[model samples]
Target: MTKDPTIAIRDCLAEIAVLHGIAAQKTLHEFRNDAVARRAAAYAIQTISEAVRRIPEDWLADFPTEPWGQIKGIGNRLRHEYFRVDDGILWEIMTTDMHALKTVREAMLARHAGAS
Candidate 1:
């Protein structure tokens, strides 16, 4: 059975939110210093990016303002160029970019719910 793209995106967003919340109280240094937390964040980011990539382009077109390409690119980099992962950029993404994605995900979910 095929999974709904909206649900997949929501799941990924929720995972990212949970992982971010786990590391929310820590400083960048603390986050970077902890291998487990760092790996969790990276995995969550990759997951979210992968989901974003799978979502249909027409569906994505509805949200013209979201950075879908960049988000998908980050996932590509994370999956393909694992060696060059920058903790600082990851920290910045977790702190800033993710909130926007979460908001968008919530909107998508609500829209999907209404359409159902």
Candidate 2:
């Protein structure tokens, strides 16, 4: 059975929230120095990337500019090249990209709330 796209959206959104909680306040240097925060954020990012892959492109039509493909790559890097994952890049994504992704996700939820 196919997983529902909206559920995927929510799952990713939930993980993004987890990421923010893990590193939203810390500066880049602070975030990079903490091993636990890095791992937690990486895990959350992996989860979000998995969920992002599940969501259909048609459902995301409203947000044409979003880098859906690159977003999916995050999980691949985390899963396959685990040792090479960069903390600074992850911090940038979590701090800057996540809010935009979160906004898109919230908009997605609002856009599809009636259907579910």
Candidate 3:
């Protein structure tokens, strides 16, 4: 039902990565005591999860290196088990993993420049 869904997904992933990075910064601690950090982290995780979920399951077979299913699973867990969210685990994903995922998403966008 959506045109260029892949492009849309790539864009969302990039956005999530950027937002996650911003939230990950120590300066953001000023907001951490409030809802800012949690909100940003929640949005980032939701966006990533949505994008991953929209991908056809078989599409992941085309990119064996991508953690396509894992992304979807994480998103589900975060959304369904909000009470169980582990801040430390979220920090790891935001700081260590999102950067690499963002890079891959950027490459996807670049490869489909005309789509945008």
Candidate 4:
């Protein structure tokens, strides 16, 4: 059976929170210099991407602001264009976009929790 869509949203929120924690540990300069942090972030982004993709289309329609297409594209780029990945861009995107994603996801979870 297909996994529940809400579970994917929860996973996305969890990964975003984890990525924020990683970002907290370092400045952009420090993040670029730290291989472990960078790798962890990449994995988190990949997970977030996958989780976003897993969200059902109907449920995703409820959050129209999210750029699900581009989010999935980022994961593809990370996987297939690994060598060309820019640390600065990754750091910037994570720090900038994550807040919006997290907020909506938290609301999504809350909305679902109330439904259940």
TM-score of every prediction relative to native: 0.89, 0.90, 0.74, 0.92
lDDT per model, in order? 0.81, 0.86, 0.68, 0.86
lDDT of 3 by residue, 71-110 (tens): 7788788888977877666667777778777776666666
In the range 3-61, model 1's lDDT, one tens digit per residue, is: 67777777777877776785677899999898888888888888888888767677788
Q: Pick the candidate with the highest lDDT.
A: 2
The clash count of every prediction, one per candidate, is 0, 0, 0, 0
Q: lDDT value for candidate 1?
A: 0.81
lDDT of 4 by residue, 27-65 (tens): 999999999989889989999988888877777788888
In candidate 3, stretches whose alpha carbon ends up further than 4 angstroms from where it belongs are 27-32, 56-59
Q: List ranges where model 2 is wrong by over 4 Å.
A: none
lDDT accuracy of residue 17 in candidate 1: 78
Residue-wise lDDT of candidate 2 within 53-107, one digit each (tens)?
Answer: 8887788777889998888898999999989888888988888899899999999
- Which one wins by TM-score: 2 or 3? 2
Angstrom error at residue 13, model 1: 2.2
Q: Which ten residues in a row have the lowest lDDT in candidate 1?
A: 107-116
Highest TM-score against the true fold, candidate: 4
User: Distance from true position, residue 47, model 4, in Å?
Assistant: 0.4
